[model samples]
Target: MIDIRLGGARPESAQGCVAVPVPAADGGAPVAITPGLLPDDVAAEAAAYLAETEHKGAAGSVQSLPRPLRQPSKLLLVGVGAGDEAGWRTAGAALARAAVREAELTVLAPAELTDAALRGLAEGLWLASYRFAMIEPKADAAPKLAQVTVAVAATPEREAALAAARTVSDLTRFARDLTNTPSQLKTPAWFVEQVLARTGARVTATVRDQDQLAAEGFGGILAVGGGSAQPPRLLQLSWAPEGATRHVVLVGKGITFDTGGIDIKPTEAMQLMRKDMGAAATVCATILAAAELDLPVRVTVLAPLAENMVSGSSWRSGDVVTHYGGLTSEVHSTDAEGRVVLADAMAYAVARLEPDLLLDLATLTGASRVALGKKTAAVFSDNEELVAGIGTAAAQAGELVWRLPLADEYVKDVAAEIADLNNAAGNPGAITAALYLREFAGPLRDRWLHVDMSAPSWSGGTDGELVKGATGWGVRTLVRWLQGLAA
Candidate 1:
């Protein structure tokens, strides 16, 4: 991890490059930076290098003073791109990648940086520096980047921005750690133990054991985890302070490791199945951030935790699983177990809490991944207000999301032969899956949105704040949305 701190003055000597923020090019060569940002000889060479190179100061563009190296002794100017929050974050990720082999960097503050922009930069640095090293490498192996110091005037705003970024980004890393853990260690019961230990007193985490689940009739959760030695669990983490009104409930599908149950996936497909619980990881981080930030809005997270493994006891494709509140779903494909368990949590949230707003998140469909690719989240709902609000918040949080239709036309495709709903809907799979979850929404259907984040939930590479696995994709957006509700 990189230690990000505020500094008053520039250091005379540094192990790595000193990066200064430069805005995007308006016209001719990118906006020029002062020679004060670099050594005279190196600055002169960089000037000549810039004239020969195509460094336009666009976001993620970096111009090393003398020459670019895997680990730079100096990189003079990094593009801040209009100096917005996203720009700062992009710059931080770019710089971190460029200087990974070096010791530290001292960055000069932009001329006028907002609190939001500062937070973005700090978060980018912290998140990009994250490495999930469960195993210790050789002593001579590449060392982690140590520190980042931003040369800026200290103020309450600066302190608040840095503190907020640390809280959110650290929790995001926490979620990443959870997602990156091997499936052998992250069983449903073990996941519940993590929730209890991690959340502690900051957020009230309650767990309903297997017996409680059976008593409460969470047939979907039980059936999904039946093959595993570790049983299913219903975990609720709440952040309710005094006098808070608007109640928001989020249900996350927490399938620890999905081997696709009786309808098992292809051999190569199960390799990344350990990340199937990404929705639960993200939701846990989001609510924890809310509690830490002391957001004055009542919010609760309902995670139906299970592991869909293959065994004699595994749920079959033709089986009917009754969810919480007695909503029966016919399992057309055991691979579609995510929505089956997610329905139970959403129904429980509605029947018990009666929240003012609801949203369910899961790595549900491959069709969504095909439609939106791996970097963007796909959302579906009939609730116009809910969609709009989430759009605004996602944009502000620098998380990309595309709204897919939640048209009722797909409802017919998901109607079951004998049960209340069918778990699998053929093509245009993303929309049909959303319609299926909406079956249990009841009154909340019109006020809810279902996020099929199959693609963004786990990343193939470490780009930006996201690491290579378990992106913790929705934490920032949900926290930002909750911040808006409090405001």
Candidate 2:
């Protein structure tokens, strides 16, 4: 974790090292040195260093020459393009990478920068510093860099800024843990137990057996999980602060594994089925982080956990099921299990919590992934202002999200012949999934946003940029947005 602060001093000044704060692009003060002053050394010996700092085709080199009148053994400058905030963040990240490799005792981020820019630098550096080298065979150890010092020159506020950066780093790592855990280890039952273990929050868990599900009319859960030996469960976790300004409901799809049921996916596609619970992992982490942070806004987290498998018992296509909210759904594809379970979960949230805002996250569709790719998640909602606010928060959090259209007329595509709706609407699967959930969202629809995170929910071979297998994608963005709401 990185310790951030605001002050007027050089990072190396305290311990005999030096850092230069460069001016912003808009120009106020040449706050510090802008990486352009160092001589470029591009050679084979520096190949490893170049690999660590290069970005988007930019040449990364090391400057070995001791600048005239400099006391340090070597003077290094990381090139951040003139006044570009994005460039600054990249430069900060690159500097951290090089510093860690060379095992420097302390590195600095010059203060006299805006909160947003400082935070961006902190985030990039911290994220880049994360190492998931656990999976590989052990190598000869190198001396570790024990500390990072960000020089806060002329800025009086130091404590709060440092605390905020630490908070962001902690929450993100927590989310990564949930996503990284295997499905067998993170089952519905296990999820409840973990939440209870955390303490300091209200938790209610209900596991509906065959008879109980039938009696309560939660056809969505039963139909989706009937094939699996593990039955389905619905868990609700809440945290309320005294005199909370508003209540928010968060619904997460918790499919332990998705075999695509009868539709069945290729073996390669099924390899990472354990990651199907990515959305649930995000929600669980969010609620826990909120409780830990003691945020003043009341929050309720709802998770509908199940596994979609293959068996004679699995609900087949054309099956009609009645959900917990009394709405009927026709299953057109067993692979579309995400929307089915989420429909009931959303309904349960609105009916019980009646929150001022409603939000749900899931690895719901491949279409969404194709549309937005791994760098950004796609957001669909009926509420424009809420969408804008979320976008702002996403930018600040350093996570990317693009608002998509609800397309009111597309609502008709989900209409069912025998039920209130069809879980699989055949066209624009992701949008249809959001629409199905909206039907049961009730009054919360006006204050809702549906996030389809179908890509990068789980990393491939190795973890990169602060994520192992599970990226913990939404925690920071949601937390930042909630903070704004509280303000």
Go through the candidates in order and give the C-alpha RMSD of each one to the true structure: 2.6, 5.4
lDDT of 1 by residue, 220-243 (tens): 999898888888899999989888
> Which TM-score value belongs to model 1?
0.94
Candidate 1 shows a clash count of: 0
User: Which pairs of residues collide in candidate 2?
Assistant: 7-152, 7-153, 7-154, 8-152, 8-153, 8-154, 12-17, 21-32, 22-32, 25-83
CA lDDT scores, all candidates in order: 0.83, 0.69
Worst 10 residues of 2 by lDDT: 55-64
Candidate achieving the largest TM-score: 1
* Model 1 CA deviation exceeding 4 Å by range: 10-16, 34-46, 66-73
TM-score of each: 0.94, 0.82
Q: Per-residue lDDT for 123 in model 1? A: 78
